[model samples]
Target: MADRRARIVLVTLSDSFSSTIEAMAQDAALAIDRWTPEGDQSWPDATAAVWLLAGGEETAALDLLAELPTNGASVFVIGSSTDHRVAAALLKGGASDYFALPGDADVVRRTLDRLVQQEGERQAADSFADAERGSVGFASVIGESAAIRRVVEQAKRVARHDNVTILIEGETGTGKEVLARAIHYHGPRAAGPFVEVNCTAIPDNLIESELFGHERGSFTGAIAAKQGLFELAHGGTLLLDEIGHLPIELQAKLLRALETREIRRVGGTKTRAVDVRVMAATHVRLAQAVARGEFREDLFYRLNVVSLRVPPLRDREGDVELLAGRFVSDLATRHGLPTPALSPEVLSALRGHPWPGNVRELRNAIERALVLSPPGTLELEQLWLERDDIPAGDRAHSLLPFPAPLENIIRAAVAAMVELTRGNKSEAARMLGISRPRLQRWLSEDTNEPTDQ
Candidate 1:
């Protein structure tokens, strides 16, 4: 007997036919609903439909079955034993299975149970595939290194909660967004959208309006009302990348929004509530920025409710070779090129090199080697691991002796500092013992000056 929770809809032309099926349905402990071919009625919400056909009624039953919305459920047919040909035709016309009149209860129950189990398995597979698709890079986080595993485990733990604010700190290209997506897609709000915005990319004047939205005629460019990221992310998660770059004035407004779970659009008097889980990622340390009076203390505490740090590639030992091989294989397959084997020298060079740009840089390097290397094992020379990979002019300045001109030396030092920090101006300034504005000025001056022939 099938479970009582399983529903069966009996479609027949005569009362006797309905009564017989209804009795069988009751014996199987299944919920039963009735419908007739001549009547115009809505489709029943059932797991399977049992259609009873009388002599010469097969044509009408087939027409009705064509109009019925099965909704992924199975449809079984019951017909006279003499009309085996008609029953076979019904099977061709989308019926799952056909039984002669006086159907066996055990046979029907077994068929329904099998269909239910198959549907459940199919739905579970789809849900898992959707979760994987929703994550960053549209795939699961890859890496077996202890450092990455710890970060991933912590993210999974944080994912159990719906609205806890999370702070992910790591150097640039450390897969902060990947971890954020994993948490959001695996969390309680897995069905919801995952919205992300780079705080550092938006202009200062527009950042506030971008986060909080704007009403019609709110500003010079506001011709129509628009919803903000927070509103769009309602019932989901919002990731703020490079959050440390958010202006101090707007930080207070963000803090208020977080505190009250509400935001007022730019130039709008009304405030609206939002149900978004906030996650922030930054390469800069907010604690240091707070001590330096660059970031707000209160907002820092608000976002740091649960801190998870993504380990840089350098610290995740042996992960380089794994990631490099993966990138090579992926790129080769994508481009229809034959996958090249990594020689011992190439592997040693990959392991020994300090990956300043981390995983992102490693991927780029692998991609370059795949395109440039021929149909054989990739060698160390093809890896391009020299400091002189910088601009030809900059290389000349860096290789110059100590007696070189002070101006050349300064420019060379700035270039070296920028490279060391993976082109991060803020970190370069900190390492050079100068303010960011001063460092920018120096770069501007250097760029404006003509290169010596």
Candidate 2:
């Protein structure tokens, strides 16, 4: 009789043992799907699956067991009470749980339930990998370098706090959100929701409402009452990526929300209480921004309670190779293709280059390589690099056109430097080899002023 709830295949050497196992499974509310010979067999599709064994068949069973698909499945083994050796052997053979039979009906049922739960988790992981841009809690930040290890350790320590806000600062593609999830899932609020909002993605005008929500008719196009990220992340962690980009108007309200532990929706009189931990990340140099009046001083102080900086991939030596292999294996598995081998030159070029875009960029490179390369292995020629092929600093110098007026060129250089350094006037002036005031005067000078050729 085939049952759909759970599947069990008895592979015992004796007919009596198989009969006993089948009867016990039926009583325990598990499905005894079939009895199969040791050769050329596959387990039935079910939530929880188990294999029964009695030792001494290691040679035959090992080959058969290795052939079973372990992905998205929970496996267990049942052994005879006297076959203690068999229990150990089955466990070593990759069975999730090993038990001696005739196992109690309740114990059997409980084991089945546990395996089913595990199977569900496996399926969830698969879904997450396919659906989301990245994995949370399950995948680590993906570098074994000392820099990454230090960040991971600090995150673990910070996660112990119940209400402390964390500020993660780093260059773009430095994996700030990955560390943020590590803190949330490993921290005191592990059971709560982990919500992320990209401050840069939302328009300046809509930001306030996005964070605090609004009642119907509060603004044009807001036809219905809405819950904001604060409400959505109640009793959990909310990650504000590119937080330095948050407009000044919304910054004040965010600070108020954090300080008062309450929020008032736009066009609504009622204030609702919320308990959420804030984790802010930025590619911008926020200290410089605060000094320049672009970012709020009080908000900066509030979020800087515990600051973590993720080192760029270039700074973390050997991380590129490690990450490339991981990405290659993962992408292949996801696409349902055989894992392609990576050549030495591929690894060397990946490591030698400074990944300005960091891990996210490397992942894109590998995914492209996997798609474009021949079926067997990935060679250096297959990798596509727009910026990686040329040094970034070199490219910056190359962008400047020659034969243009020196004054116009100087002004252009200054502007580029200012933007590159995130508007650090002092750094820009130093790079131009001029006094800060002189640089300012030049920028302040009329471009239309008659100049000596």
Candidate models: Cα lDDT each: 0.74, 0.70
lDDT of 1 by residue, 300-402 (tens): 9999999999999989978998998888888999878888888888888899999877877787668756766786446566567765556878676556358
Cα lDDT of model 2 by residue, 194-287, tens digit:
7898886677888888998875447898644556888767777899999998988888999999899998877665566788999999989899
Enumerate residue pairs that collide in model 2: none
Candidate 2 residues lying further than 4 Å off, grouped into runs, are 1-135, 386-453
Q: Count the backbone clashes (under 3 Å) in each candidate.
A: 0, 0
Pull out the clashing pairs in model 1.
none
At residue 58, give the lDDT of candidate 2.
47
**lDDT accuracy of residue 156 in candidate 1:** 83
| Candidate of highest lDDT | 1
